[model samples]
Target: MTAFKPALILESVDEIPESAYIWHWKTEHHFPFHKHNKGQLTYVEGGAAFLYTRDKTYFLPARHYMWVPPGVEHYFQHRYPANYVRTIYFFTDEDDTSDPFYTRTGIYPVNNLLLEMILYTSKWDGNVLPGTKGYRFVKAIKNILPDISEQPLPITLPTTENTRLKPVLKFIQENLAESLTLESVGQEFNYSERTLIRLFRSTMDISFFQYLKLARMIRAMGYLLETDKTISEIAWDTGYNSVSAFSNTFYKLVGKRPSDFQ
Candidate 1:
């Protein structure tokens, strides 16, 4: 049998200087499905990228990172032009008894300190080992990471090959300001209500209705967090007929008021 070869591999843990490392992305590139023995925090200092695993595909824009647990098979694509991609990997062998969040994987918000530390550590060529530092940098990181905060953007990303939901997702994205329904989509796509429901459940692991709501919610989130748009404006822009309806739906799905993300 042929051995499984990874597209990228770091030397063994003992050979490395720290618990994490970084690399830059030059031009657009795609890394085929692969697995890492250690958990990874994938962040980019510039541009954006997307990650696809067995269960879901994640869009990681700038100022964000996607966490990947150890031994999970996944693939990634870097954006076009030269981009600065920074990845920090934690050795799977590190037994952190208190780190509860290490096992969960998703896209998350990045604070200034976390961003700075990632950038700072990426500069370290490991001149000094763990204990020789003024303060144990790697040790500090292990503790700091768990509390960085997790902002779930629960959006339905399109699949690579089987994209029954692609046009539906695209419609939702482009027409976020308008009302929608699976029945309406079925009519447009020439699919029956029964087929649409089945395909959506199979393709996205969610109902067509749920995915539509999530798609709206994701766009609403971006406007809420990234812009100065009024909640009422965002409400209408995100397909809600009323601000109250939008707020309720946003709160229900996001577990926070739309204003909170601002």
Candidate 2:
């Protein structure tokens, strides 16, 4: 497939000293799977996307929001033509004057208040007259942070004791960058490739190859958030031989291009 880059427009990176930080980007950009070092609170302003993490995959549409903890590798797959994402990176260090980071959470309805706060925060012009309103506004947001964390996990994986599938899943997760074959994966589990296929379909409700792609996409998301690697390098490292091939698949899944992420 031919790779077509998605159009992305990123606003300035707002660096707030010591309290919190925010960044905004508007794009139909589908970024390959990647991760980040900071805890992230992301609101899908418009359009739809999927968020793949180690344990689950979240389908985020308009008005949906997500909270991700630091060091948890994740990525987004865009599902709409014109989606905008506004993300806030809450500094996690306790000594930085803010409270500790919230726990991981995924895909939940955006509350009206939360939505309004997001809009206000996105437009915050650093010059808040020193007063109770600013302090209260920040406090209110902080209070809701935990509520967001309490939202359910977006995607659920099967919890089967099949034992046979464990090693296979582990192998795929570990070798996300490799061109994986069901035959090779089955060999590691001492089963015929056909048997592995049956097991995955019966137990996971998805084909083995589908699961593998999801895994690769998940890993790609982590890299996109955490690293500054070029799109081509990221594609190769994530088992895509060509940037075009990777971008095509990513666009189909994420709805945007790799460059739009940064």
Candidate 3:
């Protein structure tokens, strides 16, 4: 089936209510590549959201949020249905000292304090004008972001446009459930293992194994949030034969067990 396209409002021209605004919705769909005049904060309350930029795909799992700076061209991909996506948009002053956090894009796990603050905005929609209670509350959330969102989730996969690597990456994504390895994949694509490794490093700046692990984790997160599948089922679906092995690797990378993450 073809992907559903959501109507996008370009903040650059849209008549917004104030410097601080909010828009949110829940759907198991995606937004085509788009951008805005003000920086955006996207919080995924259910399921997961994948934010795709020019050369990277970031995984925003459940209970996590992502910050996209102003004018950054990107798109959203939701793998499962009924995913709640909450967004807050705000512009910073030119001389604002905390502008650094508003300049970079990153995925951050939500803490209890921040989570409560974000959920409080659920009663609010549209431009939260200055000098209002809602406006001050949301602005305070933005200001504390730099301090709270210090460590970014490194669940991003570099994308590629190289003719040779593109098809190879696509093949890997399509066959994640299979027993895929560098040697087997190289044979399938008619390359020596060494040559395939070199291609990955040169084009993506990531080793072959590192890329595979991240790709598997991304898929696993989708299954965990989107399905009622057992942990063992999800593990095998992501190419791990042993549940313990899968859980260990997941904890090492995601800092949470599969059960906990779910």
Candidate 4:
């Protein structure tokens, strides 16, 4: 097989033929914020990816896919090297406007049936024009998505641009394994605990502990997808002393145990 070239795809996606398009590639590069004129569905394999919007970040784990509606401003980040990504872009039908699914952006886990269907299209790529068998097959994939992908993964993190809070959030992310509390963080940043609490509430609409928990979970997710660490090691790295506590909290937030997630 030929090596994947991201520059070629990035330059040609806009000028492709009518109806639909498919591009499969292995990439470690991140895309800058951009939008498409048509709806897009991207399936991920081998490694994980993160989608960033203006105010939120969405996680797309392995064996999962993300739907980006037409004209939604966003970008994709690959934390690990050489992630396999299969993407298909389609023109929206007039009837699809009535359905809420085609209008919203989300990330969903892919079942075996959907996985097989997507991989079967590896024989073809780029500009699946109307009246061809490839176009019909891909259109069917688009039609069945709403029924199979009703629930999106709930691993989104709220983002902020406030100058005062950006450094605090960065500190929490860099020191997930360290003991973090409002008082400790305030001392590091030279603010009172009460003032820090109010800052979190006003700027991010979330508590300090709440944000810390979420940041830890997100880090744990990256470890689960991209590393060979044991559950106990991952728990320790994510600031948990006991495996049970980490497993329980992981399940509660991510709907799966660390072992199952791997």
Candidate 5:
């Protein structure tokens, strides 16, 4: 993938900068490594978004969300233009809460209530000052957050330390634009095709094709957002044979056409 410009650290601007905060953006830019004093739940309703931490990379298409516990240092890029992104900062007294996705950063689904509440609260920011009854309407959304804590999350690539698989993963990432195959990669790494398949599927819990598609789609998404390249040009740049092929793959993986992000 091409390099992106440096990310910017955003400062808290909520009038009542206490237990909770809601922020939204619709731009093609990056948020640099920063943390909120409160735990965070991020929602992306339009375009594409990519969240990066020290270890893992997460992809958020439209309608997906990710949870970041308080003080989890991270940065994210607007993977496509016209991004409608919102995040809710939460304050919890119990840091040791037991939720499947709590504190563990991963992409998950968003329900209608979650989506509506986030957008509804965003509208009340400056208009409804704190201590007002309308302000508590936002806090009421907090009660809904705990219910979906156990929802299944789509885990993409996480940084692995295993020496045998580490270099192979790195190779796949570094060569995402190439016509890569498990057999070829395994041959280069001195492993059998079946061994490679098993390792990728069993160890990583993601198949080789799934992982590669993830890489290619990720790069393609960035191209669609950050550059003005034609869809066909991006298709070729990302190893797709044609524009339609790239669009199909993007739609299959991301649930939206390439032009939708454009």
Candidate 6:
């Protein structure tokens, strides 16, 4: 298993002065769990991801945005290889004492207007002249943001206070591509297979096998979008011994053929 490293502070938005810094990141491993003091609005431009906080885990796919409130500790897991994410971190006034805002986590439709703005803002070179087209574009993004919240929390994690399960969860994430069995997982942690199953079901509200499949499917999506590898290659890389089995699972979860996506 590869070591998961802490997130490298990839360009801070504050460094760009008046304009926000829009950046794209491609990740293969779980981003070392961490948080920032400033707020962040992130969108999964391509691939699938699992976002985990102290209280819950949110599954994010394309066309959905997540707003992380300031000082919230959060981490991300790329279920698939070649995970691509676009993020915009805007700086707000520190002295402005505003009401406590809920972290917005929901599935929102991606319209042409939003997609166009994302493309334009992503390439903005930080030259925003007053009363110019770029200036108006920036203003439009801010105006549309308040209307973004359709709900407070969309996908919720099963466990909220299971600190004891952290090590087990981390083990599953780290060894996702390996042929993991309940017996093996239990032996490694000195628990009986039944006990392990009970614990997993109680803590995550999903069976161990289901969680593992979700993790694998997440990684498969990343590979599909980020690499030139064929579907067979991706399936092998993601631990499927048979291409047919991998294809069937992929079709079931993503609702499209891998070749069609390519």
The most accurate candidate by lDDT is: 4
lDDT of each: 0.66, 0.62, 0.82, 0.84, 0.69, 0.63
Q: What does candidate 3's lDDT look like per residue over 176-220, in tens digits?
A: 999999999999889999999999999989998998999999899
TM-scores for all predictions: 0.69, 0.49, 0.86, 0.89, 0.61, 0.60
In candidate 5, where is summed lDDT lowest over 10 consecutive residues? 1-10
Off by over 4 Å in 2: 1-19, 30-32, 93-101, 125-139, 157-194, 197-262
Which residue pairs collide, candidate 3?
A: none
Q: Write one digit per residue (lDDT tens) for candidate 4, span 1-262.
A: 3455666666556575467878888656667778887788888778788888777788877878999988887888887764578888886786369789999888988999899988887877777888999988988898889999988987788878888888998899899998899989999999899999999899879889888888888889889988999989999999999999999999999999989988
Task: Indicate the residue-level lDDT of 231 in model 1.
Answer: 92
Write the residue-wise lDDT of candidate 6 on 1-262 in tens digits. 1222324343244453455445556565455556655456676766666777876677666566676765667777666443456666554443213423334434444557776776666655433444567656765664466565544422344434566677777787678767889998888888888998888888777888777776677666656766788898888877788989988887876667767644
The clash numbers for all candidates, in the given order, read 0, 19, 0, 0, 0, 6
lDDT of 2 by residue, 161-206 (tens): 4677767777787788888898777777788988988998887788
**Two-way TM-score contest, 2 vs 4, winner:** 4
lDDT of 5 by residue, 1-262 (tens): 1122323224543234554655565555555577765667778766667788766788766666777776677877764665567767665545327653456676776788778777776564322345766557766765556676555433455555567888998898788778898888998899999998888776677888888887888777667766789999989988888889889988887777989865
lDDT of 2: 0.62
Q: Which stretches of candidate 5 lie over 4 Å from their true place?
A: 1-9, 13-17, 95-101, 126-130, 160-171, 174-177, 181-262
Query: What would the per-residue lDDT of candidate 1 be over residues 106-178, giving only the tens digit for each residue?
Result: 7887889888777766555422344545226645665677777555555545452467767766666687787
Off by over 4 Å in 4: 1-11, 16-18
lDDT for model 3, on a 0 to 1 scale? 0.82
Against the hidden true structure, what lDDT does model 6 obtain?
0.63
Clashing pairs for predicted structure model 4, backbone only: none
Cα RMSD to the true fold for all candidates? 6.1, 13.0, 3.9, 2.3, 7.1, 7.3
